[model samples]
Target: MRTQALGGRPRQPRGGVPFMLLLAVLVSPAALAQGASRGARLFAQRCGTCHSVGEGDRVGPDLHGVLERRDEAWLTRFLESPGALIDAGDPVATALLKQFNGIRMPDQPLSEEERAGLYTFFRECTAKGKGSCKPSPTQKPGTDATPEEVALGRRLFEGTEALAQGGPSCLGCHDVRGTGVAGGGTLGPNLTFTFARHGDRGLTPLLAKLDTPLMRELYAKAPLTEEEQYALKAYLADASRDGSRPRKDRDFFFLGVVGLLAALGFIGLVWGPRGTDPRAH
Candidate 1:
C-alpha cells in the first residue's frame, strides 16, 4: 500500500521536488517580455541620456555585449553605485572612468526586479549580434522640416504663441540670438548654439525628460506637449544653423540706446531737475 500524504495524495516514491519549487520554475514567456519592455522604456528615459546599447559612445560608452565583458554580480554592484566602485579603486571601474575622460557614472538605484529586467534586456541585445541593438529612433527637426513648422517653433520660442500646457516660455529663461531687440532672458544660458553642441541624440532625451534639477522643478506639473517640443526643437535647430550668418544686432543695440535716451528725456520733462523746485524758479 502506498503511503498517503496529508492531502490524501500518494507520497512520492523517493525524493521528489516540492510543489512550490515547481511553480517557481514555471515563468511564462509573456511575463518575461513584459519585463523586457519595461526595461526598454526605462533605458530610453534614463540611460539614453548618457549611454546607448549598440550605438557608438555618447557621454558614456556603448553597452553592447557588456554582459560578456563583465560578470553579472560585478555589473550589479557597479550599477548600484559606480562612485563606490571608483572610490574603492576597482581596476575595471577605474579603467572605465579613465577611458571616459573621468566622468563617473552616477549611481542607479534599481530594485531587484527592475535590475533583472535590465539584465534580460541586455542579454537579448547581446544575442542579436554585435551592434544589433540600437536606440529607438527619435524625430529630428532637421533641415527637412517645413517652413511652417519652423515659423511655429519661432513663435513658441519667443512666446508669441502660447504653449498648450501653459508651461513657461523658452524665452523667459533662455536667450536665443535674433529673437528680438532685447533678445531672451539672461537667467538661463544662451541657446543659440545648443543644437550644435548637443545634437539630436542628446537633445531628444533632454527634451523628453527635462530631468535637470531646475527644469524638473519648473516643468514637473506643466510639461511640454509633443507638438510644442517638436516646434521648439525645430526653432532651436534653425537658430543654431543661422548663428553662422551675420545678423543686424548693431541696429538693435542702437535702437535700445535711443529708447533709453528718450525715456530719460521724458522723465526729466515730468520731474524737472533734482533739488530745484519749479515754483521757486
Candidate 2:
C-alpha cells in the first residue's frame, strides 16, 4: 500500500485502495456535471443534427417519445455496435437504418457514464410533459383555436352530447384536452396531457384513426371535421408546456425606458395643475 513520495519517503495514502476509492468518489460528480444530463446542449451540439426527441422528424425518426419505447439493453448494445444490430435483424435497429434512408447512425463510443447520462436526457425529455419546467397553469389550446373554434373543440373532447344519443361523444374512447371523464376507459393514452404532448401533426394522425379498422369498432365512426381539427389543435397548443421563454429574461431594459416616459407624464399631470393654477387658474 506504500508508494515513494517527496524525497522517496514511503507514503500510504488511503492505505492505498481507500484513497483511490475516495478520490474516485470525489471526482464523480464533476464528471457527471460535464455530461449531457446537464441539458441537451452538448448532445445537440455534438449529436442533434441527426437526432431529436421533439418529434420534429428530421433526418432521423422522431426520438421524442422513445425512452419507454426502446429497450435500454438494446440501446446499450446498439450504441456499442449499430452495424451488428442491423445485421442481426433487431426490429428497431433495422427499422431505424431503413427509415433514415439507409444512412447509418454512426457508432459513437460513449463511456459507460456518458451513455447513462444520455439515457437520463431521454427520461428528462419525457418527464417535461410538453415543456413547462416551472409550476405554470395547465397548458391550453391557443394556436389551434380561433375565438370561434374553442367551444367546438372542447365539446368534442369532453363528450357533452346528449346522453340519449347512445353514441357517447369523442371522449367515449379517445381522450383530448379538458375531458373530465376519469380513468377514461384506457383504449388510448390519457389525453389529460396529450394536447400538450402532441401538438398538431402528432395528434392529427391519431384523430384520423377514429375510423381505422382497429379503432372503427371504437373510435373511427366519429368523424371530426376540418374545423374541429383546428380547434383541437388549438386546444393542444394552449395546453402545451410553457414553450415561450420568460419575457423578463429577454429584454426588459427597453421596458424600463418606456416606464420612465410614463413616469414623466404622471409627474406632468400632477405638477402641471398645481404650478399653472398659481397664475392661469
Candidate 3:
C-alpha cells in the first residue's frame, strides 16, 4: 500500500518543494525592482537633504558602495535606530557621527519592506558604479519664475489666495520682508533669507516634506500641493534677493501711519472725556 497524506492524497517525494514558495522565488526579482523604484522616490523625498548616493557629500557622507562597506544587517539596524546605536557606543556608528561633524542621523521609522527596498536600491546603485545614480536635482523657480507666478506666490503667502489643501497660510507662522505694513505672524522664524540659507538642494526636500517637528505636526494631514510649493519657493527666492536691503515702501509706511492717526482721532471723538459746554459756563 502507498503512503497516504491528508485528504486522501498520495504523499509527495521527500525532495519536493511547495508550489507557493517556488512561485515567490521566481517573482522576487520583479518585486525587488518595483521596491527599488519606490526606494528611489523615498530617497529623493527624505534622504536627499543630507545624504547623496553618488554625489560627494552634503550634510552627511556619500552613500556610494555603502552596501559593500557594511553588511545588510548592520545597515538595517543603523537605519532603524541610529541614535540607539550611538548611545550604545557602537564603534562604526560613533565613528560616522564624529566623521560627519557630530551630526547624528535621525532614527527612521521604516518598515521591513521599505528597508528591503532601500537595500535593493543601494545594491542597484553600487552595480552602476560611482556617480552613476545621483538623485535628480530639484528645479527652483529663482530667476526663472514668471511675474504672474511670483504674484500668485505673494497672494498665497499673505492668505489672499487659499491653499488647495486647506492648510494654514504661511502668514500665520512666518514673516517675509515687504509683505505689508503689518508684516506677517511671529510664531515662526523670519523667512526673508530662507532661500539664501538653504539653497535649492536643502530647501527642496524641506518644502516637499515639511519634516521639521512643528511643521510636520501642523501639516501631517494637510500638505502643500506641488503648485503651491513652486509658487511659494518663487516668492521666497524673490524676497531673498533683496532681503539685505532696507525697506523701499516709504510711501506705504507714511500712509499706514497717517491712517492709524486718523483712526485714533475718530475713536477719541466718539469716546473722549466729557467737557462742560462753553454756553453753560
Candidate number of the best lDDT = 3
Candidate 3 residue-wise lDDT at 153: 85
Q: What is the lDDT of candidate 3?
A: 0.67
Please give the lDDT score at residue 191 for candidate 1. Answer: 64
C-alpha root-mean-square deviation, each candidate: 26.5, 24.0, 25.9
What do the candidate models score in CA lDDT, each in turn?
0.65, 0.50, 0.67
What's the residue-level lDDT of 41 in candidate 3? Answer: 62
| Model 3 residue 49 lDDT score | 81
Instruction: Put down candidate 3 lDDT per residue, 1-281, tens digits, no spaces.
Output: 11111112123233223422442453344344433367776777678789889889889889988989998889888998999999999999999999999999888799888777777778889998888777643343355678887888899899899988888888866778888559875545466666665564445556766654456677869898877877888888777775343243343233333433343344453235545433233
Backbone clash pairs for candidate 1 read none
Candidate 2 TM-score over all chains jointly: 0.34
| Tens digits of lDDT, candidate 2, 88-155 | 89988888888789988777677887677777877777788543222111122245256556665566
lDDT of 2: 0.50
Identify the runs in model 3 with alpha carbons over 4 angstroms from their true place: 1-138, 243-281
Candidate 1, residues 1-281, lDDT tens digits: the string is 11111112223333233432332232222234343366675676678789889877988999888889999999999989999999999999999999999998888788987888788878988888767666543354344467887898889888889878787777866667789559876545466656665564445556655644446677878887766677777777777776342234343233333443343444454246655745455
TM-score of each: 0.40, 0.34, 0.40
